[model samples]
Target: MTNASDAAGDEKTKTANEKAMAGSETDTTSPASPTVRTEHEDDLDDAFKYLHDHSNAESTSIDLAALRRKIDWRIVPIMFVCYVLQFVDKVVINYAAVMGINKDLALTKNNFTNVGSAFFIAYLIAEVPTGESTSSHGANKVLTHILQDISSRNFHLESGWALTCLSGESVAQRPQEQPTITLFSPHYYTKSEQAPRFAIWYSGLGFGQIIGGLISFAFQHVTNKHFKSWQAMFVFVGIATSLVGMATFFILPDSPMKAKWLSEPEKAALLKYVSINQTGIQNKNFKMRQALEVLADPQLWLLTICTICISVSSGVITTYSATLIQSFGFTPKRTALLNMPSGLVSIAAALIVGFGVRKSESRWAWLVLCCIPGMIGGGLMSFMPASNRAGLLAGIYLVNAITGTLTVIYQWTMANVSGHTKRSVAAALIAGSFSIGNIIGPQTFQARDAPRYYPANIAVMSTQAGGAVVAIVLFGYYVWANNQKDKRQAVEEGLSSSAGNEKILWENLTDKENPNFRYVY
Candidate 1:
């Protein structure tokens, strides 16, 4: 009887405290509690529920000034240098190819071309796992792993294995060490070996492409000719990249949450900024099950398809940019000069998309805004006669502008998706589509259609339009679904619209089980 009296008195005290606390405007919900079990446990459940839900909420405004002071510019520059060198080393091949790589290697029409396409096949296979590697381990870990893989593959080539294509062409290849050359034939290697090596080459490409932006930001002062210098451009870049990556091994943060360089206040600010920004998936470990679940989603698959179409359009340049420019009667040097503008456009696009676009909210608009010009430009170049050199160059720049649009698409994928597994899988899916387009892009460049491949230009224009339409429709659907889910959740909790939204904000109120999560289109 004494114990029961004590419990009643304690309950009354708790009620009084709750009422007093409720008068103030701070969330006190439990974060760790599950919304299951018996209704009879109302008081206990409410307390636990409040604790679990309120932990993520706070009233602190972002201190932009203090946060800027905390940034380690030294570390950022080193990271930037590492990324730049990685890109320049990979793409120097493009400039080198135009200069005379095929002639030096004695590469035939089929042989020289096959090596380029082979990279994509390898990229598609390796990139999925590599994306996961970034999530599971960290950016530094994945970058290190790639470096190791590339070094190993280069060693394999150096040790005497001739690279070949399925067409039975012994493309320009490094010679093997064996006295008898019979083993050097296409019969010597397995398809499995070729696939992985090809994948690695393309994986290198993916790194270069993404890091290109980081490079541009780091050294925007350097002229194109300076960057294109024979010794400094390729050889210096390779050496510098290796050195900077070593430096970054100590400085670069693995994950935002794991950044020890930040003080407690800085860390809290960072988390708050990311949370309100709607930057998804800050956790370290990769979740394979969640990735599989996302794969099973039709919305994700459709996005992949859209990615493939857009990639194919962008990929035309990967295969035929120099050749097409040469066909226009520009000298080799002039063609190289023209290519620089595209990179500039890409850099501009990254800045605008990364900064100007506040949320993943209007991805479709950004995509179309960039894409429509690309198609119009490509169409003008392809359909218009080559006699108009200035027109053709203008069209080429337009096509190049698509690079920025493609980057935005990639960013959108990262923003919309949550959980490491889904992100890895989704990244791979998008990359694989990119590879397919690369393979297909070059094929569109028929020798007969050369000097002016009207059909290839038409194809690019049409597909880009298709991609835009799909993005628009999908984005609308995503917004509509979010609204319906919000309503349902509000009704379930017996809350008014504003109150429900506040509750949801405090509790992570979106249904993880319900299939209504909007895929950023």
Candidate 2:
């Protein structure tokens, strides 16, 4: 009788609080709750229901700013290290070239070209399978576990094996989708908010480049008889990367659904917050039909083609940057130091253009921005005499700025693409195109064009210009397509007006299936 009497009194008081907070969407229905769970929150996965179900006095008082800080501290270090290792591993060869890979490996005229080309070939072949695997398995799990396997193998192979696509296992893991190259976007960030957040880790590529150059320089100075400087660089980077990979797999957040750094309420809050993306947190079950739809999607093809076109210049820089510096009459060690600046150039461009366009939500404008430098650089390198070292070197650095656009392309892919299966294929296709361009990029610098390498320089200039034009055309197409959709939607809803209704943000709908979907340009 005493317990019943107290419960009745409490219920009456709770009703009053509910009535007081009725006007707020944030007010939860529970009497003690200050915030209400919207219909949207109810639709989330069971694992994340706690976000909207908080009933305590403290639930309403969560420090979102504090939560964001906590998330940043935990997430950034993992991604930064991952990106740094990838950049270091891939371009370590550029340093290796200067460290006498040609003489040490007895790489004759076509051998260097063949070696460079071969690595990408392996990379291209692996991308689609990795993509399919990732889309089927989920990026967070697959990307890490696979890297663990490869990094271990790489440690053994680095002693003698030429570095071949050491960075091929790329997928941005939609839960934390990468700007590119396994870019993790943190869907919690809106398109506008993504750049500043992502630029922090994406800038690691620059640091990695700098560190790799120093390591190469240091190794070259070692007086070893059995192992060349290049071999030492490989072994050291490989062991460190392998260990990092193992540690990261254990420590990094697998997904927001399972992030240990965040409390249950924080996880729920983060999930609810990012529901604007229209893409869900993560979906492990792969849909075959979405994969088929990717083949028919025009946007995927355009994105892939763009990657191919831009990567042509990437191939040139990746394979020949050291040789070009050597051509400038710099000693091998000096070449390593000179090459360090390119990483800095790449870093500046990534942060500037990545965050710059993200602020305006203007992807097309940024693509053009990135390409302009490449075009100018290519022209200077093509027309200038090889003996004009400063001018040619300036061109090398300028061309690296294009690396920023590659991240933009990745961001664009994550923004416009829908459907897990199709996105997986899209990642593979875009990455594959990167390989194709790289393949073409190195071939342009044929033995025939060796000393002057005018043809390769021309290729870089023309392709970048071509890529920019294509980007503009694609931009126009996106506008045209959006207008058509708006018109069609207004008609279907029996309204003369084109105002949009609420979209079903989750449900894993394909872009074609969802009429309410809008593309980010």
Top TM-score: which candidate number?
A: 2
**lDDT computed for candidate 1:** 0.48
Model 2 spans > 4 angstroms off: 1-61, 136-138, 153-183, 494-503
lDDT of 2 by residue, 1-521 (tens): 11222222324223422332222224333544423235544443322333334433243355555665676667767777877886677677778788877777676777678667776776776665656566445555654664454444333323223333333332122112232234345444444445555565777778887898899889988878776677778778777777776777676654676677667666655554455555555555567898899888888888888888999999999888888888778999999999999999989988887667644667889988899999999998889876789998999899998878887787787777776666667767777788789888888877877776899999999999888988888798789878877788877863222112112444567777767666778
Q: Work out the TM-score per prediction.
A: 0.69, 0.84
- The alpha-carbon deviation from the true structure for residue 377 of candidate 1, after best TM-score superposition, in angstroms, is 2.1
Mind giving the per-residue lDDT tens digits that candidate 1 earns over 40-131?
Answer: 23322122243333445442454534453344242334433443444454454455455554554566555545665665565554554555
Minimum summed lDDT over a 10-residue window in model 2 is located at 170-179
The lDDT for every candidate, in the order shown, is 0.48, 0.67
Model 1 has a clash total of 16
Every candidate's CA RMSD: 14.4, 9.3
Deviation in Å, model 2, residue 235 alpha carbon: 0.6
Model 1 poorest ten-residue lDDT run: 171-180
The lDDT leader among the candidates is 2
